[model samples]
Target: MSLLALTAFAAAATASVPVHSVALDHRGGTYKVDYRAAVETRARTIGMSAGTRPSTQRCIMTATVSVDRIIADGGHELHARVPGEKTFTRNLPGDCRGRAEQLTALVEDRQPAIGAHLAAAAASDRQHALAAIDAAHNLASN
Candidate 1:
C-alpha cells in the first residue's frame, strides 16, 4: 500500500542523510563544548548465488562527529563530564587561558560509545520499518 511505501521510503531517506546543526553561545570565563553526531546506514550486498537470487542484506553504518561549539574558559582548572559519568577536574599545564582544545579532548575521550549507541538505535528502527514493508507486501500479494 501507499502507506507502507511511504514508511519504507522515509526510513531509507533518513538513514541515508546526515544531519547538521549550528549554535553559538557567548559566555565569559567558561569552557564549553557542544558535540553532535549523525549516523548513516548503508546496505551492502555480498556475492549473489545461482539464479541471481539475493543472498543477504547487510547494514553498514558510519557516523559523522562534529564539534559544534567550543568556548574557552579563563582559568587554570579544567572540568570535563559526559553523560552517565562523573565530572573530573584537571589542572592546566601552564594556565587556563589556552586549554579549550584540551578540555574538548578530555570530554570526547569518554564519548566514543555514543556513535555505536546511535547506530544501534537507527538499525533497530530500520529493521522494524523493513519488517512492516515486507508484511504489507505479502498481504497485498495474497
Candidate 2:
C-alpha cells in the first residue's frame, strides 16, 4: 500500500472511540436504563430487534437483562444503537458534553443495586436481568 493510504488507514483506525464503564443500582422495579457507548465516526453495524434493521453511521451498545417471569418467560438480550455522527475537529459542544456527563452520573448511581440483585437471584432468573444490566451499564459507562 502507498504511504499516504497507510497513514489514512491508521488514522481512521485510531479515530474510533472507546467504550467506558459506569456503576448502576436496580433496587427499583425499573429494569430499563440508558447510557452512552463509545463514539464512532464511520458507518458501523449494530444488532437490533428481530424485525429491525441494523444501523449505519451510529453509536451502538449492547444490553442483557432478566425480566420478571410475568413480563417475559425467560431472559432477554438487547443491543441499542443510536443514530448520529461525531466530529472531533474541536472540543465537544457544551450540550453534548453535558449529556455525556449526565449519562456517566446515571450509571454511577445505578450499578450497585443491579449488581447486588444479579448476585442474589437464582441462576436462570439472574442470567437474564444480570446480563442485560451489565451490558447496559458497561455501555453507558463506556
Candidate 3:
C-alpha cells in the first residue's frame, strides 16, 4: 500500500475505537514480482480553432495501452534506475504470463541496486522516527 493509503487507513482507524492494536506485517525475502495487463489512459483535446466554439471543436482522444509493472525486493533495500521513482513499468501488450516472466527477469537483473536503495531509505526513515521520539521524550521531561 502507498503511504497515502496508510495515512487514510490510520485516520479512519483512529476515528473509531478499536478493540485491538493494529499490526502491519511485512514479508522479508528476495523476490521479483510482476503485475501485468495494467491499463494507461491519457486524454487530450484536439482541433481547437479561434473561430469555432471551443466545446464544438474539442475532440477527446483516448488510447488504451497495456502495461506491466515489475518490482524487486532484496530484503530491505531497493534501488531503481529511475531515481526517486518507486515503480518500474513498461508497455507490453502480450500474454500476461509471458509478460510477467519477462518483467521478473528484468527486475531480477536490477535486484541488487533496488535492495541497496530501499535499505538506505528504510534506515533513514528509522533514524528520523527515533529522533522524533527522542525529541518528544525530552520535551515531556522538561
Clashes of each: 1, 19, 6
lDDT (10s digit) by residue, model 1, range 23-137: 2233222233223343222222233345576444322222223222222233322212222212323343232323334444433443445444434433333333334334544
Return the top candidate by TM-score: 3
> What are the per-model C-alpha RMSD values against the true structure?
24.4, 17.9, 16.0
| Per-residue C-alpha lDDT of model 3 across residues 38-134, encoded as one tens digit per residue | 2222223344355555433332322222223334343422222222334433344322222333333434444444455444444334433334334
Off by over 4 Å in 2: 1-16, 27-76, 82-85, 90-142
The Cα RMSD in angstroms, rounded to one decimal, for candidate 1 relative to the true structure is 24.4
lDDT of 2 by residue, 22-83 (tens): 23335443443322233222222233334365433222211222212212212543544333
List candidate 3 stretches off by more than 4 Å: 1-85, 93-97, 132-142
Residue 33, model 2, lDDT: 30
The global C-alpha lDDT for each of the candidates, from Candidate 1 onward, is 0.33, 0.34, 0.34
Candidate 1: residue 90 lDDT (0-100): 34
